[model samples]
Every structure is written in structure tokens, then in C-alpha cells.
Target: MKYFFFMLAAAPLSVCCQTLVHAQVISKSTQQAIPFATVGLVKQNNGTTTDEIGSFKIQCRSIEDSIIISAVGFKTARVAVSVVLSARKIELEENLVLLEEVSISWRNKAKPTTLNDFVHCPTNYYSVGLGTYRQVAQRFLAPRASMRLQSIRLCKMAGKATFRVRVYAMDSITGMPSTDLLSKELLINSSDKNVYIDLQENIVLPDRDFFIAVEWLFISSNEFRVKAKIDRQKISYSNYAPRLSFKKLTGIPTQNNCRMLNFNGSWQKPENYDSNHVFMIAAELGSQ
Candidate 1:
């Protein structure tokens, strides 16, 4: 399905009446909060994410809709919307498993250089979505059989809040983002117009291709409300701040450059993804 994004706000519309629910997600064993956990409606395409404290607020169209709470290293929790409203605290079981080891031997060659698909940066900025936990991923090709990722650079056209960064391995079968490449959370709090993230330690990039994704956190500080119409229905939805910059270019396929991950926990090619436009996110790589 095509998601909505706007460069300019249109005339405000009346907000649609919907059930606003609040809840918290926590680990079942430790009772600690699970931040940024995805809370999606079962069978419904809409949802939101928890804040750093594991708290979340989502507007529901129907109380009968079931809610799915999921995060990495945890078993997905599915509860009825009605139940969630009453419980307010959802517990997800930990599902920890060891990841297969990937060994890379890099040859000392040349100094690190920036790698990007875009030719130049433009003033054009794209709103990935107005929803929480909206993620935009860009694919990058490995220059050699193995390389060390030094850092990432993202041109923030706008925003001053916390956001999460993730690295993923390309799915051999589907060529989509599949598995997490990093072990720990890569959360960054920045109000800078230009965002640069230096990895504490360089991580090995697979010989093939990889992906870098930016996940918008659903926090009070990043709250952005806008009035818009969906499916001929008027409603106000929350869009996050720190808009990622984009520019127009040709020849590069949209699917190969960018993809979107909604609160529903699925990565898809956004209809707004045009081959002529690419997100201005780049990676720095060097030989080990």
C-alpha cells in the first residue's frame, strides 16, 4: 500500500474520532521496559511504537482489533485491543538465540572513503511518513569481498530528537532486509541538521550487499501531528521529526536504493519511492 508524505501542510481537516489507547511493553522475565517495540493491529495495517520507557499510545479504529507487540530478541505478543486498553501493560517473552558467526579477513589496502549512490545532495526533503516507528532503509553494495564500516552520514533536512539506526544483512532469497547485523542498540540523540554516526568499533560488512535503516522513535519530543485524509476519511496522525533529506537522480532503481518499514513490521517499496529521488544517507568504509 502507498503511504502518505507531504512537503507542505495542506488545509487542516477535522480529526476523526477514534479510540486512543495507552500502554507499556515490558520483558516478561526481567520486568524491564522494552523500548521501541512495535505495537501493530492484528490484520490491520496501522500501528505505533513504544518510547524509550516502553510506553506507547496508539489510536484504534475498532476495539475488536487485536494488537501485536514485537521487538528483536523477544517473542511477539498478540492481544486484543480491548484487552490492551484494560491491561495497559503488555509482557513479551524473551526469545534469545545465538547468531551464526561470520568471519571476515580484510587486507590493509587504502584509506577509508565515503560510499554513496547519489551524485549530489538537493534541497528537497522527503517525509518518510507521519506515523511512529516508520523506517527508511537504503541498500549499499560492498566494494570488495570484505570491508569495515567506519561510520554513517545522514543529511537531516529537519528534526531535533532521538532516532534509532540499524544495520541488516540482505536476504539471500528475497534481497530484502532480513537479519540484524549489530548486537547492541544503536540509538542516537541529536538535534543537528546534519547527522553523523561513528561506530564505536568498525563492524565487518559482508562481501555481498547490506542495508542501513533509520527508525523514527515514538517519543513525546518527536511528536508531529498533522491533519490529513486517508481513504476519503479525515484524521490527524502523528509524524516524527528530523526529516531525512533526498535528491533527484536517474538510472538507479527505487527498490535497489530505498525501502520502507511501517509499524506493521514489514519492509515494502513505498509508492512515494521514485527512481529519480534517493535518500541522502551514506556510509564510510575502509579496509581492515
Candidate 2:
């Protein structure tokens, strides 16, 4: 659904009394903390992330919103808002098959540039919500027939966060992302400099160009701002109005291929932004 963003402090009239729940998510088998888990209102496209210790405070908009907690390799736990608000700790069973780690080296004829090669410096940044996304075109020519996307990197500017990574096949008409290459969500934790989300899937690159998108599952807090030459051109990373500033340039087709599902419920380039300030994120590829 198309919707406008609102400030964190602003509440809708439907809010009579909100449910404030403090909870922690951890792995059931290992008893370890599961940080950056997606916890929030189900079907409402609203949520928050657990901190480093797996602790989070969920503010339910209303009792009608079902609360669900999910992670990359864990089973999703869904419960009523009231049921969650009263619980202390929730444990999620692992959905992964744990085997001894093995390393394999594959011989390739050509080695392409690293992920750092495609990424540019960030001119702006934005927070993500349900359906909110930042997209970058994948135009790299790889020698391999198929490769594994091991991890994705996001430059963390603020709070601990998590999002789903999606790789879509290019549309024949608009050259935009048309078909989903993935069946499940690839959850990413943005708290670590070394943090990367494992794709757990194969990227078949046979004259295949695509779009990589980061769709927000949950963002914890808003902590920064950006000001421009004019007062009306101010920019900030806030909920309901999360935005990325365009890098200033004279004229070019654009080395930076980026766009946003902006607050106005439209997919357009950033207003007054020169260079597409998609983000400063990296992706690492592994052997097929």
C-alpha cells in the first residue's frame, strides 16, 4: 500500500493507549542472543530491532496488530501483542542445518572487481520501514556461469537494524527488477562493521543483469540529519520521512544507479539530489 511517512513522536488518532513491551530474543538451542531480530506488528509494516544484547522495546500501535519475531536462521514466533507484552524472554528454534564448516577453492579464469569497485561514497542516507527500499542496478559481467552471493554490507549510521535482501531479474521493458530470484527473505544485521547477510542462494549470471534491493524489516532509532544550501532543502533520516540526499554533480548519465521507494508513495529519484545517493554498502561473492 502507498503511504506517507510520519514523525516518530506523531501518533495517529486511532491510538488510545499503546502497548509498550520489553522483550529479548535468543536462540533456543544455544541460549545465545539473536540481535537485530525483526519484532513488530504483523501485516502493519511497522516494527523495531533488538539491540546487541537482543533486547528491544516494542510499542504496539494498537491491540489489533499481531506481533511477530523473526530472524534469518530461526523459526518465526508469532503471538498476540498482549501475549508478547507480558512475556519475558522468547526463544526461537534454529531453522538451519548445522554441519562442520568446509572450505572449497574453485578455479576460475577471470576475477572481477570487488564489491568496493561498484560502490561510491555516500552523499546521503535513509532509514527503512516496511516496503521502503533502496535499489542498485547489477550490471557486472562475471565469467562464471553461476556464483553464490555470500554476504551484503551496509554502512551503519545509527541504530542496530535488520532488512531483507532481494535480487530480482531485470524487466525486459523498463530494465527494472521484474522477477524475484529468491523465495525467502535474507535478513541482514547492520550493527557490525564486518556484518554481512548470507544470501543462502545462488546467483546465476549468464548474460544476466539484475537489481539488488534492501527492504527494511526494522530500524531501531533515528539519529542524524543533513542540511543543504537552502532551508527548504533540509534532509534527515527520520521515520515517515526517511530520505537520502542526492550527490551534487554537473551532468552525467549517473555512475550511481540508485532510487528509493520514497515517502510520497512513489518510486523516483531523490528530489534535488544530484548523484543517486543509494547507499554505501558492499556485497561479497563466494565460490559456486
Candidate 3:
């Protein structure tokens, strides 16, 4: 039997997309670092998060490309890559926007398929891998209207895992996830093996198709807050990149198989993956 190793990687070419830069996002008036900030390249899908203390390094195509920084309670920040690189630190003002009304159907009928891969995670490396990042986006359809995303259900490997989840409408041409539904994305701190996290967003949905995206914030380092899990019995994965278990499908997928990727910096999608991950990621939706 042929074995497949699940990992995402990018080329080592010395191109504009390979240029790396670092920045620290903090409160402008208070001079305090903002933790869990979403920093990324504008006009592109490539992005990453700041550590608990508000520090991060990102790969950019060039100093000409724009960089965007956004946090839960602060106003979004956008600046030129050259300007941010020159400044080394960014300060965003806080915005106290109220959470929207939440509506989630707690019925088991609304529960998504529970898939599991029983794979173990490596405990050494900080993030998912040395030069890679892991993302799981599953294709799903909203059955009813008056839906607001309430929570995401998943199984944690061991200790606490901090990740960011985003809901997107699928693209029309490529069939991938479209733009981030909300210009701003929320951060999540998951800490249990199998539990539902109350996602604090009041997003209304229609009876249409969508995708649930999960980005693992596994940075490999003792200097920052560690969110890595461990397991001895299952197949061990590298610490450099996150290894979320997948729910193996016995039959072929009707639409897109749960999208899996191991990317090194730039945005690259897998060509032909027929299997779904045991990420067991589910969302709670309720009507208004």
C-alpha cells in the first residue's frame, strides 16, 4: 500500500513573494502589544497571526504590497509594507463594537458529520512546521435561513489550542472560498478535547453554500504562549506545522473534498485531494 504524507510547502525561489518582514502590532495610544492580531498582505489571501504578546513575522511579495492588521476589539490597520517594515511596530486604536444577536439550533439534526483520523501531533516544533502553515476549509451548505454562526465544534488533541475560524461564501469561478465574509475576523482560544466553543459573532446566513475555514495558530517557541498538543499512540506529525486529525470518508465527496494545504508563505491550494480531514469542525447557526 502506498502511504501519503500530509504536509504543505512552498518553493525556495528568491522571488518577490519570498521576501520576509516582521512587525509588532500594539495599541497606538497605550503603547501595548495587541495579541492575536490578524496580519496579512492586502489584495492577497496570505496572512498570519501575532503571538500572545503581539509580535509576528510575515512573508511579503515586495515592499510595495500593502499589509493589513486587524484585531477583535480594535480598528483594522492597513499600511504599505515598506512603511510598516521601516516602523517595525504598528498601533491600532480600540473599538468596542457590540456582539450581534446569536441564533444557533442546538438540535442534533443540525450537527455536521463527525470525522476522525486519530492522528497524533508532534510536540517539539512551535507552529505547524518550519516553512509551512496548515488550513482546513470544508464545503457546506446552509439548510435554513435566519442563521447566525454561534460556535465551532471540534476535538482538541491535548492542551489548549488557539486558532482563528472564518466563514466564507464559496467562489464562483474557482470553487474555493471567496473573500473573508466580514472584513474583520475573530480569534478563538480552544482548550478542550471535544467541545463546542461559543463563537462571539452575529452573522446572518441564507440557505446557500459556504465554507468553514480553520487556521491553526501553532507557533513553535517557548518564548510565546504555546498551544501544541501531544499524543503517543497515533501517527506523529511535525511540530513546524499543525496536524489536525481528519475524518476519512468511506465514499467519495459529492462536491469538494475537505480542502487541505501545507503552504510555505504564499497562498497555494492542493490540486486533487479526495479525502476530508477529521478536523470535525462544525458551526452553530440560529435564525433571527
Best by lDDT, which number?
Answer: 1
Cα error of candidate 2 at position 88, Å: 2.8
Q: Which stretches of candidate 3 lie over 4 Å from their true place?
A: 1-20, 28-31, 40-48, 58-70, 73-78, 93-127, 133-135, 148-150, 171-186, 199-203, 221-242, 257-269, 275-278, 285-288
Q: lDDT for model 2, on a 0 to 1 scale?
A: 0.50
Model 1 per-residue lDDT tens digits across residues 1-288? 122354222222114327888999998999999887777775555666788799988776688788888776688888898888889999999877622222222333333677773444567655534332367888888778578887777876545767777888888776778877776567777776666666656778775588999877656687677677679998766566657777666764544467777556678776645665667888888887
In the order shown, what is each candidate's alpha-carbon RMSD?
6.1, 8.2, 7.6
Evaluate all candidate structures by whole-model CA lDDT and list the values in order.
0.70, 0.50, 0.56
lDDT of 2 by residue, 1-288 (tens): 122233332233126435677878889999999876767565454556677789877555676667677665677787776766677788889876531211222233232434533344343444443333333333333334365555554443434544456666655565555555554555444444333444444455433355566555344343333222336664444452223222334555555455443322224444444353334455455555
The RMSD (Cα, Å) of candidate 1 is 6.1
* TM-score: model 3 vs. ground truth: 0.61
Q: Model 2: how far is 150 from its true place, Å?
A: 7.4
TM-score, candidate 1, is: 0.78
Q: TM-scores, in order shown?
A: 0.78, 0.52, 0.61
Deviating ranges (above 4 Å) for candidate 1: 1-18, 72-75, 95-111, 117-121, 130-133, 225-238, 250-255
Backbone clashes in model 1, listed as residue pairs: 130-239, 159-242
